[model samples]
Every structure is written in C-alpha cells, then in structure tokens.
Target: MLISNIEVIPGKRITDHLGLVQGSTVRAKHAGKDLMAGLKNIFGGELQGYTELLQESRQEAVDRMIVQAQAIGANAIINVRFSTSAIAAGASEILAYGTAVRLNDR
Candidate 1:
C-alpha cells in the first residue's frame, strides 16, 4: 500500500476514509551492544548498535501499522507519522500511525 507523510497522495483521489490506524513496538538494548556502544561513546561517533536497534523497531512498527490498515481494507495510508520514546532505562518504544483510506487507482 502507498504510505505518505502528507495528507494527500499525488495522482490518486481518496475514495473513502477508514479512520486512524496505529502500531507500536518496544525494544530493549542488548548488553553486548550496550557495552560496545559505551566503548564507542568514549571515541564519540555514531552508535551503530543503537542506530540498528531503532531502525529495526521503526520497521516493525510500520509493518504492523500496514497490517492493521490492510485488515481494515485500506488501499493506502496518509499522514503517516512516527514517534519514539525511552519507556525504560534500556528500552525504547516506537510507534507508527496514519489515517487509513481507500484511494482511486489513478
């Protein structure tokens, strides 16, 4: 399905609004990764481990949001948005949300 951060999808008309859909996931840091990240912190550079973790989390959240949209028979999702927060000391939560809509093919 087409997903966009904007309210409208170019070249397509919104036929129906299926309302809001959302998905979220929480991930915890791995001890080994934390150790490596800590070491990297000393040198002060990109934290690959944490970066990878957030990437994975974001993907999962988006995947889940897509599933929910599909289940509601939506052809696309508009105004897609993402949020992240530290829910715990070593854990982070990622959320994906959007307005589910049915769109004209062209």
Candidate 2:
C-alpha cells in the first residue's frame, strides 16, 4: 500500500475513505542495555541500543497499521502520523496511524 505523511498523494486520486487505522507496540529497555545507556549519558553520546529498539518498534507499528488497512480493503494510507509515549519507567509505546483510503488505478 502507498503510505505517505502528506494528506495528498501526488497524481493519485482517492476513491474511497476507509476511516482511520492505527497500530501500536510497547517496548521495555533491556536491563543490560539500560546500564550501558546510563554510562553513555555521562559521556553524552547516542544510545545505540535504544536507537535500534525504537527504530524497530516504529517499523513494527507501521507494519501492523498496514495490515489493518489492507484488511479493510484500503490500497493506501495518507496523513500518516506517529506518536511515542512512556508507558513506565523503562517502557514506551510507539503508535502509527493514518487515514485508510482506496486509490484509483490512474
């Protein structure tokens, strides 16, 4: 499916609106990684572990959103948005959402 952050997809006509669709996932920090991150905080560098974790989490959320759209017969998703929220001291939720729509072949 065509997924875009913009409301309109250039040159593509939307045929139907399937309403909003969303997916989310929660992840907690690995204890070992958290300890490493604490050390890195003192040195002021990127936390590679958390970076990778969030990246994967975002992708998973998007993938799940696509599945929902596809199930509802949507060929595209527009006005895509993402959100991140802390679920607990060491956990966070990543959410992906968009308006599911059908696109004309042309």
Candidate 3:
C-alpha cells in the first residue's frame, strides 16, 4: 500500500475514505542502553540505542497501521503521521495514524 505524509496524493484521486486507521506500541528503555546513554549525555552525543529503538518501534507501528488499512479495503493511506507520548519513566508509546482510502490515477 502507498503511504504519504501529504494530505493528498498528486496525480491520484481518493475514491473512498475508509476513516481513521492507527497502531501503537509501547517500549521501555534497556538498563544497559540507558547507562550508555547517560554517559553519552555528558559528552552531548547522539543516543544510538534510543534512536534505534524508536526507529524499530516506528516501523512496527506503521506496519500494523497498514494491516488495519488492508482490513478496511484501502488501496493506500494518506496523511500518514506519527506521534509519541511518554508512558512511564523509561517507557514511551509510538503511534502511527492515517486516513485509509481507495485511490485511482487521475
């Protein structure tokens, strides 16, 4: 399925709006990674561990969102967006959402 951050797809017409589709995952920080991150913080460098975790979680959320879209018979997803919220001291939730739609070339 095609996914885009834009509200509308150029050269394509949305034939049907299947409503909102969303998926989310909550992840907690690993102790070892957190320790490493704390050390890196002193030097003000990138936190690779957290970055990787977020990337993986984001992809998972997107994948699940696609599954939801497919269940609704959507050919594509438009206005795709992501959001995150802190779930706990060391855990966070990642969410992917979009409008499920049937699209046709215009």
Candidate 4:
C-alpha cells in the first residue's frame, strides 16, 4: 500500500475514503540496555541501544496501522502522522495514524 505524509498522492485519485486508522505500542527500556546507555552517557556519546529501541517501536506502530488499513480494504494511507509520549519514567508510547483510502490511477 502507498503511504505518504502528504494529503494528496500525485497521479492517483482517491476513490473511496475508508476513514481514520491508528496503531500504537508501549515499550520500556531494558535493564541491560539501560545500563549500557548510562555508561555511554558518562562518555557523552550516542546511546545506540536507546536509539534502536525507539526506531523499532516506531516501525512496529506503523506496521500495525497498515494492517488496520488493509483490513478495511484501503489501498493507501494519506496524511500519515506519528507521535511519541512518555508513559512512565522508563517507558514510552508510540502512535501512528492516517486516513485510509482507496485509490485509482488518474
């Protein structure tokens, strides 16, 4: 399925609006990874572990959103958006949302 941040897709016409779809996930920092991140913080360098965690979380959220869209027979998703929030001291929630639509070649 085609996905984009823009409301309109070039060379494609929106044939049906399937409504809004969303997916989200919550994740916490692993103790081992957190310890490594803390050590890296002392050296004032990038926390690869934390970075990887967030990236993976984001992808999972997006994938879930796509599954929802597909289940509703949507061929594409437009105006895709992502949000992140701290759920707790060590946990964070990631969300992905978009308008599901059926498209046809113009």
Candidate 4 lDDT trough over 10 residues, lowest sum: 37-46
On residues 1-106, what C-alpha lDDT tens digit does candidate 2 reach at each position?
Answer: 8999999888889999999999999999999999999999899988999999999999999999999999999999999999999979989999999999999966
Model 2, position 18: C-alpha lDDT score: 96
Pairs with steric clashes in candidate 3: none
Using lDDT, rank the candidates from best to worst.
2, 4, 3, 1
lDDT of 1 by residue, 1-106 (tens): 9899998888899999999999999999999999999899899999988888899889999999999999999989999999999989998899999999999967
User: TM-score per candidate, in order?
Assistant: 0.96, 0.97, 0.95, 0.96
After superposition, the stretches of candidate 2 with alpha carbons farther than 4 Å from their true spots are none
Q: What's the TM for model 1?
A: 0.96
Candidate 4 lDDT, 1-106, residue by residue in tens: 9999999999999999999999999999999998998888789988888889999999999999999999999999999999999979999999999999999999
lDDT of candidate 3 over 16-79, digit per residue (tens): 9999999999999999999999899899978989999999999999999999999989999999
- Which residue window of length 10 is worst by lDDT in model 3? 41-50
